[model samples]
Target chain A: MSTLVLPDQQVRVENTTVRHVRPTRRLGASLRKTLYRSGAIIGFLLVWELVPQFVLEPASRVFLPPLHEVLQQLWKMIISGDLGTHIVASLGRSAIGFILAVIIGVPVGLVVAWFAKVGDFLNPLLEVFRNTAALALLPVFTLLLGIGELSKVSIVLYAAFFPVLLNTILGARSVDPLLIRAGKTLGLNNFEIFSKVVLPASVPIIFTGIRMAGTSAVLVLIAAEMIGAKAGLGYLITNSQASFLIPKMYAAILTVAVLGFVVNAALVALEQHFSRWARA
Target chain B: MSTIEIKNLTKKFLRSGANESTAVTAIESLDLRIEDGEFFTLVGPSGCGKSTLLDILAGLSTPSHGEVLVDGEPISGPSLERSVVFQQYALFPWLTAAANVLVGLESQARHGQGPNKADRRARAHEYLRLVGLEGVEDKYPHELSGGMRQRVAIARALAHEPKVLLMDEPFAALDAQTREQLQDLLLDIWKRTRTTIVFITHGIEEAVYLGQKVAVMSAKPGKITEIVDIELQDRQAVDDIRSTRQFGEYRHYLWTLLHRHGRQGEEATIDKTLITSGASA
Candidate 1:
């Protein structure tokens, strides 16, 4: 070992390499975590199964059916391809609206943020529009485009756009000045600097925006479908409820919840893929 | 021949929403010349405009008065011929070490009669090796240590084969041992490359050890107060030279010059220049 003295501390540079201890070696900690996660789900299912089976009277069980009955109903829906139809319908509308929001929002955000004159011109109007709710604009969209796919998609678009645009603006503007200067010193022009330095720096935030937009788009699509749609999960829930089919309504609600979770997971995966450099 | 010449250069920063009369002067009427292929250092306390001066020389910032000429021509803006190693590392966190160096080569390669893609990769690898970073071609800036990041920045600056390398306290953030190690490595690189270097630092010992000539600056509307010539017969044996009494004398002289100027400027009571001069005092 060679010893070196610094202004604040003495450092010993050891020739012998140190091995990292495996986290798995601490079995108790990891085992408890696994057990806790599994226990929560299993425990929840047990309560769902038992509450209606033992605690609830026959009359109450009419509204809150046992877990197995609900599962049976869901299974029947799947076999008949009804669940698949509703899922595909909901996903298609959400996809179209969210994708449109991304295409328009990202570039508009970057352009406004990068160009000061443009940002100054648009910021006040953006804030005003963002504050006004997408749900509130439902009547306006229906009046303009009619109660069809366009109106439903437009509402989702409105809901998804602001989050992506606002977050993107924040991302592009928050790029460190030091990095910009470094690019300049390396003889990169403004366009090159923006593409190389600013864009990469903004990736993490932009992904956050995308994730937010995805969630918002799914939410707004469901709400729009609830207001006026025939084949989607939202319509399935409302129709089943009106007809007193509690199990089918619960299945539709569960499907929508699962779909939202899946969308979030997919977005998280995309964020991880694009910003792997940051994890380093 | 002087590679860089500053003739009465000045820089003023306008306060936000403030009129012209409220502008703060970062540099004023500074005249300096850096010789070709020479290791020159600018040492001053905080707010002494040493960074401003370097920025002006790098052509990253325009001088409000007079001009900075590189190779007898005025510097209009940043060019591939003059590159800088920023104090913050600024290694483009998204890029790996090799790719960071490649950024310089890519820009230079855009012009005709430049290195091909294969040669540019080879040169990037060569520079990384020169900075003693091997088998880490794919390591991103965030994955590396502070010293390693600075070394990558140094390698990136050198990869372009710039006529002048401008470094703004590149070692200021490193530990003593790492700083010393980098100092020795830099001297070795300087000997081999023989590129004109203008290094900025706050440490008197660093200035004495690395530079053939050191310029000291005063704070509050900063300007160069003194320039000291360092005569070292053996630049190769830097460790031995640093241990000699002559090195102590040079360090002491520069320290005294900085101390005097720092004290004189401290009493001015100018609230605008809150940053202490380069001197630790």
Candidate 2:
């Protein structure tokens, strides 16, 4: 994992990418950042593999499985298509809940922010709900909606919704009034100004909320699955742990972490595209 | 002809929160007329209501007491016929340079007063070129320098072929070299377009250099103290108008007026730069 080859031609490249052309230096810096992160992760994995062998007793070693055993189990599950099934199940639930949250949250947030009356009414109500954690309402959701996909998805939705909604309101509110005044002088009517100026200006900030919600959706879905679901990454983790399949449990946990990281990376890319395109 | 007429104009804002009792009078019973195709500039200290007056003329703000008329008709709300260039270069950040200019063109297209879609795009390109910004159609506002951004803003303001253009200290944020360059560029553009302009600035040199008639304004119940008609009719023909004796005299006179009746509510600090620029050297 730490097989990083030193780039021999960097000196010439850095000199050529001097003062004006900045993207090359930025790209190099980003690569360096990624390398440092990968190095830390590799260092952690090495510690995980080695620490249990020398430090833990044989009885406790079963609980703290080595990295190679986890990887082996992960590979075996992949070859047998078991990992794929759990991944598909987990991803589908997470995506559905996240998409639904976004669909409901964004427009509602925009409308609420745009209309003073709607904002005045919803602000206090939203403030109350946002403070109350989604997991706190899990039993209520299960009792009302039953221990099915609906309840699980509802938990994810509830977890994800507030971040998206609140951020959107903040983004819309944070639009520069100077821009609005400029829009008026440019002869843009109310709807035109809202669509052209307010909407576009708020997008980068709105994406921040969506990114937070993305993380929440996945995390909350996993927790919800552990509570009720029969087949998901979270369920697999609990099941393998109950059966003393520590390696398989570790593998599932690793998969969930990777999935969460991937989702976050994709959202970060989307946000960067919007913001960078604004300057392009 | 966009003959702007100001009749007993006034504007007041009720102070928010702690000082909500007394209304802040930004402009009080101000009256001024800008003729068709005239290059008019308003000069005052920072607290004076020159920007407020410009905003009222642009219809971004309503007059509290009297009215402003363009071509003998009372101004309503902000319309395409009157465009404004703001000091901060209020170009839309999300849009490319040409796209920002296209925003103003959209108003013309709405009224069927503009050309076809293709010509409109061409016209946006043309307006950008008119402001000396070429090969930057796809560049967004954040990508450009402050001066370039302001040029894009000027292009946007002029894109609709507005009968009157109201500029509120448009070059205040720019560097000295860029400001001078833009001033000459603006003069050249005004020569060709002949659009009625109401420019607001605190600099006496900028006021004299730009306006055919420079209106000196006093702060605290803001009103025009004097309107000095500039006689440098062949300003374009001169080698360096700012260096001319007549130009210096106009700048010095405006500076003296400002020094005497600049701000009624605050102490007027002597500007060091104006002392040299207003010199008849």
Candidate 3:
């Protein structure tokens, strides 16, 4: 029998294809996107530098320090190692609390998602807890765990837990039924399907939760530290403000903002690495 | 002895609405026997319960009153001996093509007696090669074409070495050219492996082309209307077979049978929906 080459029908396979268009001017497109994003930061910084230096300083010296003065104070604190100590203390607390939340939240979320009955039973209780602010619970935690590292960490854990828990539950529950069916057709047991398919699929969404929780963890930790702490970034800000050191207060606040930004960026990188398969 | 035996198989579905419940009879008293190593196809209209029947055969869905026996034993649940290829190429998006195939092998009942990890990896590679996907093993599902993803699904099914392969409109989503290409590829694989295949499709040409015997089914309560034996002179050279008079006659025969029975089910559906909507209004 003679082999016949199949005639290719007008197959516009590209019509069904979803591809990121390679811009003819790749640098231009990316640079434009970057500029659009950083436009607000640049405009804000320019206003901060110009208005505070040129206008505010001459009008009121003690009230609003120039951006340069704040930067200078930040430099001085860095040289004296005080700023480094506060940075370490703040990061350490957030890290410990966030890690604990992840450790507690992930398995609990997976269990609730995997077992519908357990989830249904816990739904009301979780809703109640999730609704109550972690900051509102700070006093109770302080009384229960004492006004120390334990109390501060507890508050931070409370803040961090709900985001991760909720996201993980959503992710696990939303796993594509097609994948579950495929797993069944492959003769995989329920546990095998959960481990091999559901867990892997939920990783991206779990990362999203982790990122959100990390932001809240830092915010709550700083607030908790401000209550009674001598060695954290929050302490630096409140203490400087009470002592009437405007520049130092500004410096501490700026550092905290930068730290939050860095933490979020790191989480995004981790998510990208884990979910490499999800993107083309 | 047949590799698969469907004895008086019936499946009914209960569709419960807000206020009322109705029993939708999907299949009623369907009997089919697929010989070992034979390629059999089931063709029917949409909602004909052809898929329900296939699911029952795969043991993913239980028959309401009867049983599906594979190799002389009644199937209780999904087994390694019978694997399914869903209409949507249900390749795990998280896994690479090779990993997807390996997963099937690892999940099979014979995994305990099967080759070690390295050997299993090699077998996966071999099957991917068999499907003409040699260099794309590391590519994720999103990175591959629709046809390529379906090929990976096929490779995954074949890697487990199932005695009977059940495909549910596997190539229905592909473009025409790719669909024809895959049809040829499947025929080639079936010829080489001689795995007893039960393929389900609404396409009469596809059913006739792929199967030794094509079973035409009717809907509303699905039942086999006819089983036509396709006796082509040169099955290997099927590229120009559709142009032949014999192929057209078979197509015309199946089309007429379907045209007669398929319309009643659809009209009933339209009338029922209209009545329901009128009642609600």
Candidate 4:
């Protein structure tokens, strides 16, 4: 009888392919994905580098400059150290604004979700503000805070606030009732349940919101600088364009694009780090 | 001493809609006393309110009428003394298995011994080992299999060393083999700790296999139909108990009660069909 049970258990173990087979397949699939993404990026750059030289006239070349000329301008800016200072200033404002938005938005979202009557009262107001674009509020902010660093940072704050607020509310409200019940039964107090169960469960969605907010902050920073600034990539682009220095203008635009890309990539890395539990 | 005492308990759920509909009764005018240190199960068909009754005992929901007393004190809300394991393996998805267990221990320590971080982690390790998940403590919920996740949930619940363990269909999502293994593990834990347990399940065989007292409930506006006490010669493992003739008798008896409820459901369906067809004609 014991021998009978042994073979039956062995067969049962053999039948569960999830316990063994799928993990190996998942590794192969991720490798393929990395290769595919890198291949597409390399292909795009190659096309970008070669296309203008072969396809257009000399006078018309102003529309699409050669990759080497853009790189040369980029090199000059780096050597002069103007690019680094501008990048740092813009990054500082954006980071400060984004962090402030998160600090304010997360608690407001929690309160809204916790009290239904409060949510009902505030939701309409939130919706009205969220729909009103951050760029649209630029004039209002400039008038109130002046056309200084405060006004610029305020615009980024407005841009980043909504996604974080909305996503945190969504994440908090959608927690599993069963998990709450489990928490209650385990003798966890209201605070403990909120901290241990609700907060941790909401993390992945909240991190997604944070990543979106980070990207939006970078975007708003560029727009803010473009409107009125003496230094920064946006100032460089507008000033160069006025003087008819097309290569310098393109270099400024390139710097903005690269800054946005790097900030977004860092956010993605942070989200992945925090949301490892959500992978399952 | 009785672990839990319920007297004249009634609960109703209000329908939230345009008509201001009358409340739907869940459990009405009920009374039960679960003995200390016994593995008790409530078994019924869906809509029989077994889960609702468990919720009341766990203090997740307030009864519309009557009262529940745990060890002679009325249950106002959830307490650490009565730990619950849910069907959906409610392990914190953001934490590793060890961290999840540590969260439970930390909550317990808030009122009790206030264990430091190192002590809490050590205690979490002990409970994890008890559930036979020794080496996989660092793994997140997504990294582990379903069975492993459930084991982590069990470990988290047990880490607090609650006096009463409440489980609501904790093994319903698992395969037959995993369910059996978990059932055996549950029995071993219960035998060792002698904690009063209130388990709810729809499976008649499972209720009979695990519970010392099986409380069978009727469908809708649920009521306890009968409470049968299992009288076995020896306290045996689940596999050994299943092979016994007494287990078969208890299983058949529960099936008969459930069969009667099934017939009532069919009759209700037929009545609805006839009324709709007649109106259409």
Candidate 5:
């Protein structure tokens, strides 16, 4: 019995030691993650910069303009005031569209979720419309609203609306039954439960939807502008492309990418600030 | 005096399926009367529909048969008269501990005797202190320990100053040590506030320790099996009472009652598993 117990105790001691050593191993694992991520990004950038420098001739560079030329065109656009107007126009469209989506989508989502009968009736309708791509409606919008800012803005709204509405519905519907019970126990009415418990609990998911909608809004606006528009970043890119100014077209494209990135970053920051109570 | 009268409460959940499945009776013919300010507990095995009974009383779920009356008034829906602390720490994760409590107070103010924001905040702070979470008001639920989160849930429930408080295994998730600590805190709060509490738990020791009257319930289509009235002669602390002969007797009695229900639950679960496995196979 003593001999058997000695090996068992040794095994227990080894297990404890292994548990103690695990956290340091985790730290090393995290370090490896950071190293891998940075290495991949730096390697990609280096290859992108080097490919144009060494691999391509100057004549063929018209199709794939070097990073430097694109950067130079970008700088010129920034200095000149043409880029600013286009960027502002795109930003304004996305902002208005996203705001409209939230205003209409959130309340509608809440009402639909709260009333099961209404949700049952409307779900198929929403599913049908949501699946119908906003791009598909571009022709109709152009005919009805004309090829103006209204068509462009409305297109952005249509693109953004589905995500916000769908996410809000999902968020509202998925509120923890326990939380609702807890709300009821606290003597909260239906509306109080919705406003105080359900809405606040759904914020993180709803914000995710809003962020997705914001990105979609920008993407759709760009495509809409490219179809037919006098102003906006998409217009600048299409105009430059049509005129065969490859560098300037690339510059406009880069600006749109940067604008989308900034908007996403801003929304993420807002989500973090508002949902400070959520687990990181 | 805010007594609760639960009369012939029966709840049946409709099972949705192609076969038009039979209604699952959660609670059946359950009648209980909790005196105002009594520390009453409902103890049973899981699936005994103890929670369903509490839900009906809280007005979260309507009973298919009979009624729940608080001070002779029928419960229609959730009202501030009865507040509940759930088994799971249902502290709103999006709000800080204080803010969650504030939500309760704000709702109360909106419907009841309205108070200014300052007054509401003060009331929230007061309840937070009562739950021993005064310094951690700004902490989010995820940031707090399980014990602290449950305390915040309790604080939120109490902030509304409801006449009756319904608790459904609020300490079920806590470890034994933490559970005991919370149990004591609950007793202290109950003593100070004299809030009529109807606590639901499967823990016999816990039911025996805190309850002035422990009502044992039976499984599926649940009904009250037995009621044990606890007498604490010296008004001793929970720990002190645990060592007494009367406490041992009460514990033994509840344990025996709960054991019978536990065996029934085990048999039901085995049957269910076998049927499911059979279907799959």
Candidate 6:
């Protein structure tokens, strides 16, 4: 125990020796890293702000408003409480559709991948349906389900489902056969092998599919809303454009971008949480 | 009571898919007896079905003919009593070393190997310590070195207290120095546990050093040619017995036995690159 304690302490000291000697250098290095990481985004934003203000003609100003004007309109909508209502409507529809897709698609994928008979029967159908565009079915879904939340939500679910299902099947199927052999040697049954070995091993690939589905969910939801909806960011953008409130339309579009960014960030965080062991 | 009796055991792999005529014999009428609690080593030319034989003993693959019995009970599938340590350290990448050991313990719980869950965990730690991997139990396989990962694999194989341990070129991937170190470590553990071990390797040095009975095999229809009983002194003392003249004599004898094809003019060489490589399904 005494020997163990000394080695651990020595390791800790070795790890932090540079920091202890020159803490300012470490801080400066991190600051430089941050600057380098964000340099491109900062440049892009500056270009957006300056290009419309200086380069574009006055006639083009109505179509491509200045960034500050769009920001000001965004603030106006926030203070007036109109932005909150639209955001809630859009988020609710997207969230419900995405979550539903995940809840249904993942298990179906697991089942099909694990059992060969099921996979053989469903493979051709899936190939056809997944290839036939989700947006192509928009009019059909609207006509069948009516233009209520059902149609919009169903469209989002349809768009997201294939990615989650296909990726999960691929994930489950791609598990190292060596790992399964090891499990069998340890006396694991088929179910035990599936749960203990196959499921955990398939996580990284499955997460990749879910990330794709997450992007799909948001994009499909916005498209559905643009086609037919009383409220939501897509509806707001379309309505503002129709009313010739160009700045507000730009602001609503920015809000939609922010929402997509947040969903992606959340999905990435979840992926890291599950697969931290994979980090070298 | 873990005596393994292989009675006319044979395995064949079809060269082309769905072709019955071109079936190549991997193991042909292989008959051998491994006494209880003995360290057995098998050596052969590359592609001589040494790994295939190990897989069959572990109940991982079915023999085309005949049967393998452990204490007169024929095995049809994998059992908790027989644990296998593959050359590829097949630890679950997502699991820590401790969790991997725990998997083995849990598998053997039905056989009443470990008393309970808590005792099983303690045994897992004990086995890891036995393999000289005391502090890295919580580390994932990728975080450890190749030798360390193989140690975890050994710990997992032994943690369940199996009656027989099957190893297939377990140290073939390590560097020369690490390989020697693990060889010594394995000897020490085998001495203590007295578990029935069937080790397969292409290295003649490994076969001579660790095995009580080293069986030499021939390829093109894999079958045992000769069984050499090694008699050496002070194996438990840990002084390098490999340098001794008696060890050299056994090693040279096995080398000549493997190289007999040169005199016969059947094949030029035994595929030197495949000295440590094997094929499997």
Kindly list the per-residue Cα lDDT of model 4 for residues A39-72, writing each as its tens digit. 9887876776677788777787776687778879
User: For candidate 2, what is the total of clashing residue pairs?
Assistant: 0
Model 4's TM-score against the true structure: 0.88
DockQ ranking, best first: 6, 3, 4, 1, 5, 2
Least well predicted 10-residue stretch by lDDT in candidate 6 chain B? B272-281
- Over the stretch B1-281, how does candidate 2's per-residue lDDT look in tens digits? 39999999989988777845678999999888899999999999998988888888888889889999999999999988899999998888888899999997886787677777898899999988877777789987776777788888999999889999999999999988778878877887787888998899989999888888989998898999888877665665778888986677677777777887634454434443454454423
DockQ of each: 0.40, 0.30, 0.41, 0.41, 0.31, 0.46
lDDT of 3 at A101: 98
CAPRI-style quality class for the chain A–B interface of candidate 3 = acceptable
Model 5 sits at a Cα RMSD from the real structure of: 9.8
Which 10-residue window in model 3 chain A sums to the lowest lDDT? A2-11
In order of appearance, the predictions have TM-scores of: 0.91, 0.91, 0.91, 0.88, 0.85, 0.91
Give the Å error, residue B95, model 4: 2.5
TM-score of 3: 0.91
lDDT of 4 by residue, B24-118 (tens): 89998999999899989999988988889988988889999999998899999887778888889987777788988887677767776646778
In order, the B-chain TM-scores come to 0.90, 0.91, 0.91, 0.90, 0.89, 0.90
Q: Which residue pairs clash within candidate 3?
A: none
lDDT of 1 by residue, A13-84 (tens): 311246777777768788988998899889988998999989999999988888888889999999999999
DockQ of 2: 0.30
The model with the greater lDDT, 2 or 5, is 2
Specify the poorest-scoring 10-residue window by lDDT in model 5 chain A: A1-10
Q: Name the TM-score of candidate 6.
A: 0.91
Please give the C-alpha DockQ score of model 5.
0.31
